[model samples]
Target: MPLKQPIGQKRLTNVAIVKYKKKGNWFETACYKNKVVDWRNGTETDLDEVLQTTAVFKNVSKGVLAKEKDLVDAFGTNDERAICTEILTRGDLQVSEKERKLEYENLFKGVATVLSEKCVDPNTNRPYTITMIERALKDVHFNVDPKKSAKVQAFGEALPLLQERFSIQRANMRLRLKLAAACKDEIQSRLAEHKVIVESKEADGATVAIVCQADPGLYQVLLALVRDLGKGHGHLEVVSLAVQREGMSGEGQASGDIQGILKEQQRASELSQVPYVTSQPASTTGRLRARSEEDSMAEVSYPRGPISGIPDDVTRKPMFLEIDGLQPGWEVELTKRGESGVVDAVFFSPSGEKVGAFVQARRAALSASKKAAAAQSTVE
Candidate 1:
């Protein structure tokens, strides 16, 4: 039997054919170095013919081989078809063909420097020397295929467009990651806050809803009111509260007194300085004295221990304290000493006695600072 061809040689045999499987997968059979693979499945008889063809010429057909030899005679081995194929596979595949010829002159001009320094000549298989490489680079044009042809072009061109697309994708991914991380951190930190667990009947199941006791809408409205009061009122604050069972009993007294005090103070402060009365009422209607001076004949309904002397407005609405920026946790010390100092802080609590430690500390600090500043300014 004839010597079996090597695996590589068999892969490129003249009869190299591909047959699609029933599932439509391509199957490789035989091949040759020069002849193209038969995309249409050639039979055993066709394979025999291909083998005969291969026997006549080892690599390429006789005509091609003769042409290669003739070109080499005039322009040297640089013009060899084998060399051209090698150049195509290598970096020279990017070379522009418009400025130069297709044979030795073009190939050498395109890749001589690169072959000298970065690559080796296929035929010689020798490494490129630095001096020869430098000489080639100086004379050679960059062998890059420009994306826009005298033929057709698209909205986005080649590599640069691809790079821009990749960059935008990367940025969006990073932004999403950052947002996710921030949300996770917030959920972990605020988890300790006491929330009312509300149950909702849904189509699938009962959903547990966590509700914050502090009303965000009320807080926002209060903040806006304070802002309108100017920078001098930056320390002013308000809190939302709900009345307890016992607290509702004193609503009438609290509402009357609180509204009265606020209106009197506001009127006095405005008149003593620069009073510009507008059509808008200072406080809600039917709350404060209907007629400002009409209440002069009214008897003072003062409570004995002063605790019963709560304002009517205070009684109607829930009791809330106004304080400076308090973080969390503070004590409420209601004493003669507290009265002497500016009531700069307000304490929040479910019970009357125990106050938030954070609010107390904050109020104490702010009051001390304001007093000290006033004292210093007086002395100066």
Candidate 2:
């Protein structure tokens, strides 16, 4: 028997490949899997721990070394370490099948964690634990994508299914709004869309203060409503709120007198004359009547707010609201060229509750009326 050859130190036993392509050629590097991943995610910094050897290769799996001239041409350097760094930073990471499965499992956990934190069970009014969310996901067979973010997947995909399965919903946000007192009718439909506990309605000299708790999605819609309907004389202040409880009984109230995004062109004309409304402690309001008896507009009808200096041009085209732009719960108001003021458009479901039910009922009623009209066609 002869002496055995010396055993070389096998460092890169668990090798992972990272490859970069430049000038139609691939430059590859071998790195330790866990260390390279930790480095990529900013948790690891030691390059020595990440790299088995800083050797740049044409094909890492085949152990074919890259030529010095090609390396210089492709990466602008002949240094193996520099070329390796470039490859690792800018290249695609080649993970094994096992790593892909591991990453998908991680994504599942992340999405579950997010859903558990952001939503609540409607029946119990309590947050679902991570375990509960995970188990429910299994029962429903919810698929989590490894490529997407946890928050995105949780909200866009998981929440709707969770709602169907468990009736889970996001917690409500308490919001406060103030506009010209006469303008409240403009957005009454929108206000009725949620669980609005009338916190208070005061007529300040120029404004009416209204506070209520509602679904979180309504804030931006309400903002746009003020811009379009209130024309810049309204604002909603809701910097603080959490999940819904009994109602808007919390100590939180509107913080300040923030104004709405009034139209820039009308700012000088509309905002200056009207005193901006401010929320008092608990939204106690006392609005002065905005119209006077002698004003010609006051002669025609329902409550009208004083937005003076706006040109009264019936020459303006009659606005036809698009069906897509209408929200179901909002009360719609329309006026003719020569009509004196007002009566309610909606005679039923004034509280704005069960809007889906209200919609189905309204459709059925319309269908019946159409059929009766067809049946009663008297040719004479």
Candidate with top TM-score is 2
Error of 2 at 162 (Å): 3.0
Task: Give me candidate 2's TM-score against the actual structure.
Answer: 0.45
Model 2: how far is 202 from its true place, Å?
Answer: 6.3
Instruction: Judge candidate 2 at residue 104 and give its lDDT.
Output: 79
Off by over 4 Å in 2: 1-17, 29-91, 96-102, 178-182, 193-210, 229-234, 237-380
Predicted structure 1: lDDT: 0.27
Give residue 173's error in model 2 in angstroms. Answer: 3.4
Per-model TM against the reference: 0.13, 0.45
Model 1 spans with C-alpha error above 4 angstroms: 1-263, 271-331, 335-380
Q: Tens digit of lDDT per residue, candidate 1, span 166-268?
A: 1100000000001122233332233234221112111222211222222222345334433443333322222213211111111122233323323433443
The sequence of per-residue lDDT tens digits that candidate 2 reaches over residues 149-219 is 77788989987776554445665566678888678765565677653545566777778777766666777
